[model samples]
Target: MPDLGKYADAVLSSYAVSLVLLVALIALSIARSRRVARELHEVEERVKHG
Candidate 1:
């Protein structure tokens, strides 16, 4: 907050966009990890039974 002066809008908007993208990336990664973990568990169960 140290006097962005004339470029305040541009700078703030960039920060907002960056934060949003970061959150979305994190969410997608967690979802993908969970899905892969579940699929691996299922495969392991099938192999054990077979």
Candidate 2:
């Protein structure tokens, strides 16, 4: 990695914030996809029976 120590504390803080946000976003998207897949399966089952 580059020399993060050369930058000010604000820079380090910004990088930390960005990393957290990206991780959260990726996790949320994965959860959302799983939920959608489950819902889709339920809907398909209902259509097949009714």
Per-candidate TM vs. native?
0.95, 0.82
The residue-by-residue lDDT of candidate 2 on 7-41, one tens digit each, is 76879899899999999999999999999999999
Q: In model 2, which runs have C-alpha deviations exceeding 4 angstroms?
A: 1-7
Runs with alpha carbons beyond 4 Å of true place in candidate 1: none
Q: What is the lDDT of residue 45 in candidate 1?
A: 98
Query: Candidate 2: how large is its RMSD?
Result: 2.1
lDDT of 2 at 26: 100
> Considering every candidate listed, which one attains the maximal lDDT?
1
lDDT of 1: 0.98
Clash pairs, candidate 1, are: none
- Top-TM-score candidate index: 1
TM-score of 2: 0.82
What is the lDDT, from 0 to 100, of the residue 37 in candidate 1?
Answer: 100
